[model samples]
Structure formats: structure tokens, C-alpha cells
Target: MATSRLGFSFLLSLFLAVACSTVARQLRFVTVIYRHGDRSPIKAYPKDPYQESDWPQGFGQLSQVGMMQHWELGQALRTRYSGFLNKSYDRQEAYIRSTDCDRTLMSAEANLAGLYPPEGSQLFNPNISWQPVPVHTVPESQDRLLKFPLLNCPRYQQLQRETRQSAEYVNKTRENANFMAMVANETGIQNISLESVWSVYDTLFCEQSHNLTLPPWVSPNVLQRLKDLKDFSFRFLFGIHRQVEKGRLQGGVLLGQILKNISEAANTSRPQRLKLITYSAHDTTVVALQMALNVYNGKQTPYASCHMFELYEEDSGNFSVEMYFRNESGKEPFPVALPDCPQRCPLQDFLLKTQSVISQEWDHDCQVPSTSQDTEVIIALAVCGSILFLLVILLLTVLFRLQAQPTGYRHVSDEGEDQP
Candidate 1:
């Protein structure tokens, strides 16, 4: 009886140990990257549904809907990280960063409003729901012009040029002809650019309503078609199946940052995981990062779309990273499961399991296949053209040497006078 009693105690202790480890494994560190919430178009082209006057808040400002969207996101974070972030905010534990844009800044603020609501000592006023915390940012001008700057990376620009010029992209644009005609009809504008068509499409879709005072030329069929085109474009940008591989590569920088952060967190020795790392930037910021991580799944990644990456250290001290996305849809985010790990995969192993994903996602060609289709030939042609130009210049120099006047030899006229 005594021996049986000891064995039961030991088993109980083991089970408790396992359960504790499991709970710890469930929680790791977290890094979230998100775009700002819904807002008006930054600026409309010559023809768009909402003129500046249409919105009381003006263009690019976060709407009340946007605020609610972020507030929901914050609440979600609070729920998700309830045990992790503590009931109160701590400077040492949590940090938030936002782009200088009003929408993003405000979005982050709204999110925090949800993440860390006031409780106990943290509350300045007893009646308030939350205490205010700082959301960080650099100047918008600097962000746009310099520092993590977009100086038109020649490589990305070249890729963009190639992507735009690709038969697929060109054809897609051409197929959008009906969309162009429809926008032209609505705005009463002549010769609408492909981009203008998209701008108008976004305007109408975002307004969530058709123009009440539609121009006489506007057709309901055209409106429906434009809406379809808009959906297609959003799918092209963020959908799982449509966005090309190259875009996934071009936007890998932010994804790289995500992995790097996980790696750092995994390397740390403590119960404290990276509480939070918030990225504040444009819609492209979210898209690029998502594409690199191969997570966007070709959705529009609306303003203030936030991606949460979590890493949990297991009982054996192994680490894993789990990815989560919030897009103001108030739905559970799409999840990417890494192999050799649980629902929450270890960071290092996640990186390894996902290396192929990263490689494929970003369109890196380091391991070119033995065979390829037309793209390879186009690449070969460019390379050969470059090499041929170099060779031609070399040949020209040689020919000039063979046929040219010798040094120290001068031509003389019949009078034996050397030419000057």
C-alpha cells in the first residue's frame, strides 16, 4: 500500500510537470506587424466616387469604423495575450510602434485601447476604460523619403518593371478594359489609365454604396463589373492562389525581420518573451511582409491589418513560432502550421521548416531547376546580351588596334611634310 501510494504521488507530480510545461509551451513570445485600419483614399485621381468634400474627416484619416476595427483588434489581442501581457501595461514588457500617418497612429492607439485597458493602479481616473500609452513613430516625410526609406530599390523597381511588363500582367491589365470603360463612364473622364480604373473601383467598394447621384452615363452593369474587378485585384494582391511568386520575394524584407525577431526571442533565456513588436507603415508594408512570409493569401490586407507571430519555448527548451493575422474582419486569422512543431511551432524549427517556404515565397532562384519555361530564356537573353556587349566592346578595341595608326608614325604628304 505504501509503495502504491508513492507511485501515485510520483505519477501525479509527473502529470503536473507535463501540464505546466505544456502551458508554458503554449505561450512564447509575440511580434505583431499590422497596417493601419480603414481610411479614405490618400488622394483620388481626376475621377473618383468620393471627392474630398464627400468625407467629413478628409482623405486618409481613419473613420469611426476604422477605429472600431482596431478596437476590436486590441480586444482580440487582450484576449489572446491575457495571461502574457499582464492585466496592466509595463514599459519593460510591451512596446508599440506606428507609422507617422494619422490613421496608423490612431489605429495603434485604438488597438492599445483594447490591449491594455485600465485596471487598479494603472488607471488615472476611476471611470475610464483604459490608460493612455505611447505609440511610437518617425516623421511621415522622413518615412516616405528616408529611413527604412523607399529610394526605388533598383532591384525591386526592375522586378516591378518586369512584373508589369510580363505577359501575364500585361494581359490582366488589357482584360481590365471593361473596367476602364466603366470608370470612364462614371467620372465622365476620357482615356482612363489602368490605375485610375482601380482607384475608382476602390472608392466605390470602400464607400460600400454606389454613387447616389450617378452620372447619366453610369450603368448598373458597369458598377457590378467594376466591383468584380476590384475583388479580382484584391485577390491578385493578397489571395492565396493569384499573386505571383516574385511579389512574394520582393516583400520578403519584412518577413525576414519577423524571423529574425523570433530567432532573437528564442535565443533569449527567460520566462519573458518579446512582449510585442509593432510595425507601423503603409498597406504595402503589411503586404510585403505577408508575401515574404507567404501568409497574405492574396487578400487586400486592408489598412491596419496586423499579423501576430508567437514563439513558445517547450518543456525541453525548444522554441516554436505560430503566425496569426487580424484584418478587421472580426474573424479568426488564417494560420500557417510549421512541421515538426505543434500548433505553436518552435522558432528555429519553424524557420527550418519554412526555409523552403521563404525561398519559394520570395522567388529566390539560387537553386534553379535543371529545366525552366520561358522566363529562364528571357533571363538568359538579358545575361547573354550583357555578356555580348562586353565581348563586342573587347572585339572593337582589338580591331581598332589592328587597323589603327601606330604610335610614333606620322603620315607625310608628297612634299615629305609630316601631318600636324
Candidate 2:
């Protein structure tokens, strides 16, 4: 009996040890996609007093408020990952990529200023209190993979058109017709549609955010409707009809790339040089990625909002992907659940669930005929061409024979082959 008790105690101890170790998994990597900080409205509606000259940095440029917003974000990041990241700046440990836009690039620089405040020998100038950390970017004209609102995607455009014609869309449009027309008249923009109403709202929102007075025609109710419209637009942009198909073409491309990075980071054989990767881009970029993940909250993501991917390695030789979103500057990032997934979702499960949305060749899928459709068209065209070719050959042969036999001159009239 004593021997039995001793064996059971040993087994219990081993089980406890394993359980504790499993709970203490290590964070292997992190990928964060954040919107650029506040900015002037990209453009103003017709007859709006605010213009390019109103902003010191010109239209669409990051403002002083924007810089401070990102600076705070950097501080938040540093605080959130204090022990997980190196105390000193390590180029090999982190990678940052941004859209090649003035606002996005500048936001990245500002965020880095807070994220990696120079310490020890890394500080170049004691008075400046900042160091230059490289923020890499591909020009907007050349970048399609990382940025959202991807242009020239024929498939996505077709999906958008279909979505607009969907019953839900038509109902919404009909319901909002009176309000939309009111906006068009008040803003003095002759052809303002649901798609373009955001610009007017954005102009008003930005001006209000900075405490500027608004036009008398605008009211709190008007602004609320505008905000609602913008939210609807984002949903329409990414999640309307055939949500999965739209995702596969637009945002899923980026999601797949991010998953690839997570898998590589989790691999034990790979030389884990990169601990963190950050994408500095627009709010649309954030919304599109979240929509593909099926975690979007159907609201416009606030400026400086960040969607983070945290990769973890468990003691049982498994990896997991955890997501969080920080849409408010003053608040902690909330957990974003993948559908039917645990907060710490297993990497294999993550891949399995997202596989349907992951696109292999985004451009090819967006531009050309689908493989099955193309095959049917090709077969039909081939059969038709073969029949046409035979007819052409027969006609040419008869003409040749007739010409060969007609060498002898024969008097011919317009009537009945000259009655010869």
C-alpha cells in the first residue's frame, strides 16, 4: 500500500509540473498593424471654407495632434511589451513597414520616437532625445500586397457592384435618400453620393476634433448620420455580398502573409532574428484586415488604432496566435476572437479556419477569368473556330478552281452568265 501511494504521488507531481509549464508559454513574435495618427481631412467637400491652406502641413498631411497621438501609442507599446522586447533598440529584433504616404511615414517615425527612445550609447545627441530608426516603405503606386484599398482589383470591384445591388444595400439607400439629398444640398456638392459623403463628414469631424466651428447647416444629428454612413461604407467595402470572396481578394492577401510570418517565427529551426513587425498604414488597411479575420466591430477604427498579432509557443511543442485591438488611445487593447477560436488560438486551427479566405494569386484571381470558366470558353471558341476554318477553306478552293478554268475568254452579260 505504501509503495502504491508513493507511485501515485510521483505521477501527480509530474502532471502538475507539465500543467504549470504549459501555462507559462513564451511569446515568440508579434505583428502589429496600426493606423496613422490624426490628420487633416484628405479633401474637403465643395463650398467648405477649410482648404489646403488651412493646415500647416497642407491637405491630408499629419498634424501636430497626429504626431502626439502616435507618440503616445509608442509609449503604450513600450509599456505593453516591456520585458518581451529589448531595452535598447535592436534593428535585427524589429522591422517596421509603412505606406509611402506623408501621414503614414511621419506617423511611423513619431511612433518609433516613443517606442525606442535612445538609451545608453545608442543616444546620438543627448539634447534631441530621439534616434533614427529606419521605417521602410514601398511607394503607394507600386505597393499592392500590404496596403488595403488595393486598386485595379477587377474581382473586388465586381463584388462591390454586386454588393451595392444587394437587397440590404438598396433598402439602406432608399431609407437614407432624404438625408443624403439634404447633405448634398447643404454641402453644396452637386453629386454627393453615399460613397462620397464620408469626405463631408470627415471634414466636419476633423474640424470639430480641433474645436473649429462648423457650418450652421450641420447639426449633431447630421454628424451622427454621417458617422453611421461611413461605418456602413467600410462594411460595404469589405463585408457586403460574398464576404468571404471579397476577403480572399483584398485583405486576405495580407492576412495570409501575416500568418506565414507567424508560422516561420514559431518554427524552431529558423534563425529567429525578428521579434516584432509593425505596419503603419491607414484606417482602411486596419478595417480590411480585420474584416478578413472576421473580427471587425463594424465601426470606423479610430486614429492610432492598432490590431496586434501575438504568436506564442507552448510547452507541448505547439504554437498559437492571439489577437488584440487598441482603438482608443487611453485604453488597453481588447482581445479580438477569431471565430470559434479560443483567445489563444492554436496556430494550426488558425490556418485551417483562414485557409478558405487565403488567396494564392491575388492579381490573377482579381483580373482574369476563373479557371473552370476559362476552360469552358476556350473549348467553345475552339469548336466554333474549327467549323469556320473548314468553311473558309471550301470557299477558297472553289474560287481557285473556277479561276484556273476561266483562262479562255467568254463573252458574258449581266443576265444568266451572258446566256453562253
Candidate 3:
């Protein structure tokens, strides 16, 4: 009996040690990219009863529901990373960046309000529960990091043109031609294509969400069909054809920055002070990142959706990356695995798999080889070279004529003068 008890104690100690070691895999860093909360429609359809003035804060501004959505998201973040983050707001520990838009900027502020509510000595105002947390942004025109589907990319534009002509796109267009025409006629839109359909759907969806009475024509079935098209449009924009190259031109830019942050955090040589980096942006931003990662589900990313990256240092000192997506307010974020890699993807493997999508030279890659420009340059050079060749030939002919013709005492001049 004494021996058996001793053996049991030994086994218990071994099990506890193994469990502790497993639990010691510390999270080194975290990065979150989230869509801004709900907002008023960016624009209303011409035939729609609701106009810009109908919304309390005007067009594209955050609604009260939006503020609450972000606040709840912030609270979720606080709960998810309670132990990892400091109890009080620490400027050194966290950074938040938002696009230079009214909705996105406000969403960031609201999210921060929830994530770091003023506590103890940190409370500045007794009357208000909220404290100011700095949210950074740049001019919309200048911001390439957060603002996605960079329309300025010539190659990306070319890709869009190509996508339109693709069999899948053509088939969809052909199948939905009557539907699109009807929508265009109903909305008073002059021409409706896959790209423009989203706006109409967005207007209706926003109105529906806000309890506004949608037009009689906008039936439940119509709304559902519009949603399907909207999702397809997102896929078409990001991944219908030549997805890898598209990603390089569009989403890869953001992915490169994310990978860089992860790398910096993983470096054990440096003092790892920063814990969390949050990007408060739009649906397109979330989609862009997921598309780059090749993990995008073909669905419209809802408002206040979050995509998280957590870098962990394992017991063996190897770093791994894990991704989670939280689209719903009530449910936990589900794990998203890197393609051909485990959920806890090794740092090196994650980098290797994602390297193709990461643009080495975005500007160079975005440059579509302009055949017209090249042809013009070649033609100009040819014209100049031909003119120079003709000039040389004319000069040589003139010199030959002077030498061969009876050039007024040209050859015999010196001898004739001496003889004379």
C-alpha cells in the first residue's frame, strides 16, 4: 500500500509538470484588424425614399448603434486578452490606427473606450467614465496601409477589366442581366454592373437595419439576391481570377506590414514592450487581409468584424502564429488557419507560405506594361535614328561628289602651282 501511494504521487507530479510546461507557451504579440461598426449609407439610391438628410448624422457617419457595436467589441477584446494586456491603459503597450474617415476614427475611439476604461488614478474626469486614447490616422489620399482596393493601381485596374471578361463573371452577368437591368431601372441608376450593384444593396441594407421602411419593390427575396451579388462582387474584386497576383497588388501591401510587425515582435533580442496593435478600418480592409492570407470566406464582413493575429513563443522557444475571426458580437472568434499549415502555424512556415502574395515592389508590380507607351517610344526613337542616318548619307554623298567630280583644280592645284 505504501509503495502504491508513492507511485501515484510520482505520476501526479509528472502530469502537473507537463501541464505547466504546456501552459508556459506565452503569447508574445497580438495584431487585430477590424471593420468599423455600422454607419449610415454612404449614398442613397435616387429612387429611395430615404436621402442623406434622413440620417441623423448625415451620410457615412457612425450611428449610435455603431458606437455601441464598437464598445462591445472593445469589451470582447479586453476579456479575451485580460491577462496579456495591462489593467490600465499603457501608451507603450498598445497602438491604434484608423483610416481618416469619420466612421472609422469614431469606431476606434469607441473601441478604445471599451478596451481601456479609466481606472483608479487613470481617471481624468469624474463626471465621465471615458478617457481619451490617442487614435492615429493619415489623410485618406495618402493612406495606403489601411485603405484597400487601391484603385490607383494600373495593373489592378487591368485585373479588374480581366475579371469582368472572365467566363465566371460573364456567365453571372448573362444570367443576371434582367435582374440587374430591373435594379438599375428601379434605383434610377443609369447603368448597373457587378461593381455598382453593391452600392444599391448597401443603401437598402443600411436602411433596413435602421428600421426605415424600404421601398415596396425591395422584397426579402430581392434583398437576399442583392446580398449574394454583393458577396460575389467582393470575391470578384479580391479573388475571382488570378487571386495571387491580385492579392499582391491589393491586399498584399497590408499583409506585408502585418508580417513585419509579427517579425519585429518575435525577435527575442529586442525588448518586446508592445503587446497589441489595433487597426480600426472598414469591411474592405478585413477582406483584403483575409484574401491575402487565402482565408476569406465568401461572405460580406459584417460591421465591427475583427481579424486577430496572435504570435506565441512555445516552450521550445519557437514562435508560431494563430489567427481568429470574430464577426458576431455574441460568439467566440473561430480559428483561421494559414493554407497548408496548422492552426498554430510556425513563424517560418507562415512566412514561407505567404511570401508569394507579399509584394516585393508594389509600384513596379502595379505598373501595367503600356504597349502604347512602349510603341510611342520605339516609333520616336526610330524616327530620330532614321533622320540621323539620312543626314549621314547626305553628308557622305556631298563629300563624294566634291571628290569625284571635276572639283575646280582640286587635286592638281599644289603641283600645277609649283610647275607654273
Please report, in order, the local distance difference test score of every candidate based on alpha carbons: 0.65, 0.89, 0.93
Q: Which pairs clash in the backbone of model 3?
A: none
* Runs in model 3 lying further than 4 Å from the true structure: 2-6, 370-420
**Candidate 1: tens digits of C-alpha lDDT, residues 1-420:** 999999999999999998897676656568887777777766655655558888778887888877887888888888878877777888778777777778888988888898888888888988888788988778766553112323334434444445556676578788877767666765776877543455665665556532245544446676676656654554344333323343334454455556776777666554343467766566667665555455555556676577778877677777666777776566777776533466566566667655643443223342333343358788989999999999999999999987887778866678876768
Give the TM-score of each candidate.
0.72, 0.86, 0.90
Best by lDDT: 3
Q: Rank candidates by lDDT, best first.
A: 3, 2, 1
RMSD in Å for candidate 1, one decimal?
8.0
Collision pairs in model 2 = 413-418
Query: Candidate 2 lDDT, tens digit per residue, 272-356?
Result: 8899999999988998898898999899999999999999888888888899999898899999989999998999999999998
lDDT winner between candidates 2 and 3? 3
RMSD of each: 8.0, 5.4, 4.3
Native-vs-model 2 lDDT? 0.89
Q: On residues 160-191, what C-alpha lDDT tens digit does candidate 3 reach at each position? A: 88899999999999999999999999999987
Worst 10 residues of 3 by lDDT: 411-420
Candidate 2 residues lying further than 4 Å off, grouped into runs, are 1-24, 368-420
